[model samples]
Target: MSKKTVELSFPKLVLIIATTVFSFTSMSNAFYLMSYAAMPWYIVAGLLFFVPYALIVSEFTGNLGQYSGGLYSWIDHSLSQKAAFLTTFLWYSSYTIWLASLFMKLWIPLSILSFGQDLTTRTASFWHIPQIYWLGLGSCILVLIVVFLINKGFFTISRFMLLGGSLIALLFVVMAVSNLILLVNHHGQLSQPMQQHILLNSPNRDYQGLLGNLGFFIFGITAFGGLDTVASLVDRVGHNKRRFPFAILIAAILITVTYLAGIFLWGASANWAAIFTNQKVSLGNAMYFLMFNLGHQLGGVLGLSSAGTLILSQIFLRLTGLVLFWAYIGLIMTIAYAPLKSIITGTPKNFWPHFLTKENKQGIASHAVLGQGLLIIGLIWLVVFSNAHAVNLYNNLTLMTNVSRSIPYLIVAIAFIQFRKQQHDYQLIAPRYANLASGLVITTILSAISFSIILPLFKAHYLESMLLLIGPMIFSIIAVILYHHFNRQIELS
Candidate 1:
């Protein structure tokens, strides 16, 4: 008997939206913003900054569809191949850093659990054993295995990521509301004045410094960097033109509201000093502390659930990171090989050319996969061996990832401006709103200003920071030189 055949449809566009937003919002940076910056100011800034960027991205995505490589395609079509390559290269580079940072976060909790409270003591038993290093190494190995499994086709992993994200979100809301309820019922008042002057004073007193005390608002904006991931998956989305915009709007509102709730509760429950001094810098930790205190009133079960949720959320985060890393590797392999395959086998560009263009093994060039795989392995190795400076390394990596992701946004802004001017006959299906052009202008200006502001924040000793900024530029230059060199060699051949 012949085996039954089945076709698989691409996942719904809404799922893509949910996953993308979840990925960005769950970053530890978002939590940092709530603890450090002005909560109300952040809410306002998020609306001002993210909304336009979202609209621009949605429109560009709607116009381009799956044929273009989404962001890479938009840049390539609007600018040059070199620019396109740089955009994609930067994007991939940023995700590499993101993967490393997430692994680091997961390792932190594991280390605490393994080493107990003495984990912080430099001369403790755990320190003598260097348990954190071993834990981090083990985590890396686990991640590698997970990535391998994902590559072998674990489609359900995406759904699991979404589910985990939802659970995490629910935990955040519950903890936030619980803290607020407790504060209100106990007649808790702000420990210090909530006035502007009180918030502005810093113990360090470096008021005029270049790194001038970035508040929660700035951090919130920075944390929003990963939202563009949704736009990247536009091609894989169903009803992209209709549903994508709504998804973006909904996600932005949910994230903003969640952040605001956390900040208000934190303010009510703890003073600025307590918030700053808390060693549990992670969002999960803050929520756990709040819930544990509030749970004493509601019985122990709620507190236990909160702790359980945080632990489960970490597992989900690790799994999601692994899946994303492998998916990116797969994408890069496909992109690198498609041209080479066309050249080597002389495959013509026509409809239904060959199975090589359809199936994963056949379509994806092996050499490209090997190259990227080696890079990933090397990065994991660096993370493991550099344990002494791991905290600094992770922070630098996070900043770099943020900067690199911003590059595509900048390029897209330029592209949108150009398309509006040159393509007069091209109709914009969605009518432009009032101040839309102004919004684009402001985004472009802010993009430029923010890059300038953040570049110097990287200290010189942080090699990862230097590499994150310089690596892509170097790769671009090398590509150009090779292109010319190869052309000459071909002439000589």
Candidate 2:
């Protein structure tokens, strides 16, 4: 609220939004997802779903740049205040699951970098506790780290995102080029040559199996999200009215190109079936497999010993894993900060408890950020005590995060249609019906995609599925009760 607070320039705003959109692990998820289908499936999702969805979000953000509450304000203006509260509440709550999964995401890459293999088969001594305990412990540390940074203000957070986003881009470029080199010389551990068939042909999967993989579609769809992360910073973007949409356009193009290149390299390096079978550790396995085998072949060509090549390959894989870890850490930090910012600032003060609305010296939502961190830590502990296997825990949390996050988007879609129908002078270029139809279709697609993830979780294991589903419902019910309580308290005060 200070008059002297620095606003974001065009470039910084672009980096903030870009980092939010270009999640490296999400790209890895896409690579993992592609195991069920051909490259064109990714293209189809990008074109039909991501592109339209990104533009819709951009339009919403840009049009409402003057408002503090990102989606909440937009929906409140267009629809009802109750609708805005529910949308923001759902979106905000999703991060409870997401932060838990983020710890797993970070832990996976760090394990690969340090141990040079999957930790499920290995062990790490941490205060005499098993390695699984360490996973939750480390996640608790990361949650606190994010809470600290959020209290420091988003200016500092934006720098981390910029650095992380750049490193992730470098990771894709290096991997893609390295894989291309190996494929060219026929040097990796591929079962067959890196030919057009593997790159372009559909997998021999049955319909039911493919239906199961629709969960990954939700993963991929959610990856292109976080455009709303910048909703809190809409006013910070210099010349936002013009530059906001332009930035989204550029970010969308960059993400598409990067994903396509990364997917191609991944498919070229490993078999689809193997990737599926090794889904838990597919990314690390694929990266190390390619580098190790390529180094072996190149060493033979250079008249070096096999031992020397193995050393060289290990060095490369370690460095790659390290870079990926840092890059993804940046993403986790942003996810930690942005959604909380959006919901806390977007929701009206009447609905927020006094402590939740309190700000720090840096104008950051200190108490709200701390509360979110506590929720993540509690969730992490719950995971630790439940004694679930790490892989299953990760899979269930991913589904829960996707489903929780998608509900807000459905609300936004309805808001967009309602807003466009009412506001004749809006600057968006699309025809009224075009925007309306896109909202309906995209929301429908996302809803079905969310169901695909939910159904599988229920069928595969009733307990975890109920836990995941009920977590959101429980949170939403609590939130509503609190909203009414806080509103009444505010009115009395």
Candidate 3:
């Protein structure tokens, strides 16, 4: 066998991490939720929910270091092969939903602009010819063509995404912070302090209520979901084993600051009571309102600039998200085809098919890309037919992706705790001060929150909700059984 080689620069590595941090639609959703759930305590809850997971994941990546199969490999190495498969399965499932949700993000904003308020209400009669469906379909096609063009070359898609996404995030922060400063300066009191009090009071009745709210805060923590994409690409990072952690730390700090400032500004600028009561209001709309007010306070040009920034940011974010959706779908299709290739092509059926499964020279998997394209086409058809509520679809898709994407974190936490127990090796540097026990405790808390809050939130129907929770567990159980069975078969052969 010949040796294999890959090389990537430091700048590319940074780009990868930034793309991972900002790629998910949930980041915007989290901001919107904060506007509604505007309690001071929720910020604390967000910290508790996300920090442990991030630290644990960082430790895992540092320890694992470019191991093949990323999460699947890590889990297989630490636990059983079955556990790894289940992790990959969940990850794939989540991205599938994410792919669907990207369509919703594109559709939702465009529909609102084109059809106005009637878009949400014109359900059955309009499903066949909704503006978003056509727009989303067109966007998907455009993205796929770009992916095709970059098929044989190194694409700086991540860099472009990061630049655009960061600007949008920055614009959001500035608009929000500017509004907050203006409110405090004018009123000599925070605009919506009472609403903060109410959100905090709503969960005071029981510890569980507090815990539930804390769990709900996981929505914010998980906003950093795509970080693993960076971790997965660690091999491509120059000096990655040393510098990647620093990059992640910087990214995490940036994310937290942006989130906190955005929330603070949103509360100070808006009527918190009205925001909490009304489902129609969104983070984007809140920013727009703030700009309108700012215009009155400052002048039309400044107000228009704020408004323009918000609009431009949304447009940029959606377009970038649309591209990423195709990329993720492409990744999933690659994985899905691996099992099929082993079955049909008379390749040896084994747990790891590294040779046949490797990427081409351009980091593209030929089989996976083809498979992903086919699947995306199928999903586009489904979107055309279901004509589902765009916002609901977006929420459900985000939930689906989060649940699936979280499996790796769970695996990493379990592995980290186990390694510390078995080896007593406490030498590795962690981003935070948590010891193994503390890490495990935090992991358990976060897992419980994920199970309790995320599952219920996504469930559209009672039965579907139940299945959403139960289905992965069942799949995990089945995978364990099959792994042992296959091992025995291999032994006999």
Record all residue pairs in model 2 with backbone atoms less than 3 Å apart, i.e. clashing.
Answer: 69-346
Candidate 3 least-lDDT 10 residues = 339-348
* For model 2, the run of ten residues with the poorest summed lDDT: 199-208
Writing each residue's lDDT as its tens digit, candidate 2 over 1-493 gives 2111345566665666676677555555555545424356667667766777677777776677666676788789889877787777777777667777667668766776898765743566667888777777877888888789867876677677777876766766666766676566665444334566544444533322555455555555656677666555665444554567777777778777777766666655556565455545454455555544445544555566878877766766776678778877777777776667667777666457768877888778788888888987887787774655855665665555555676676677777777777654445547755575565546656666456546656468666566656655766786688678767887898
Q: Where's the lowest-lDDT run of ten residues in candidate 1?
A: 1-10
Model 2 TM-score relative to the real fold: 0.83
> Could you estimate the TM-score for every candidate?
0.68, 0.83, 0.70
Clashing pairs in 1: 37-215, 37-216
Q: Point to the candidate with the largest lDDT.
A: 2
For candidate 1, write residues 299-384 as lDDT tens digits.
33245475665554444334333443333333332222222222222212221123323334323333333444455556666765
RMSD, candidate 2, Å: 4.1
- What digit string (tens of lDDT, one per residue) describes model 3 on residues 1-493? 0112234455545544554464233443443444435335435534654455556556656666555355555566567666666666566555555554454444444443343322432434346776555655775684465446334423343334344454444555556556666665657555556454455544222223555455455555555556655555443344555566666666666666666555555545455455435555554344333443433444332454756755544443344334434434433333233222222122124533345335566664444545555665566666664655744554554544444455656666676565544442323444245464346535654565455544455434554454446656654666567657666767776
lDDT score for residue 149 of model 3: 39
Off by over 4 Å in 3: 1-19, 22-43, 109-136, 139-143, 146-154, 180-188, 194-199, 202-215, 274-279, 282-358, 386-403, 421-461, 474-493
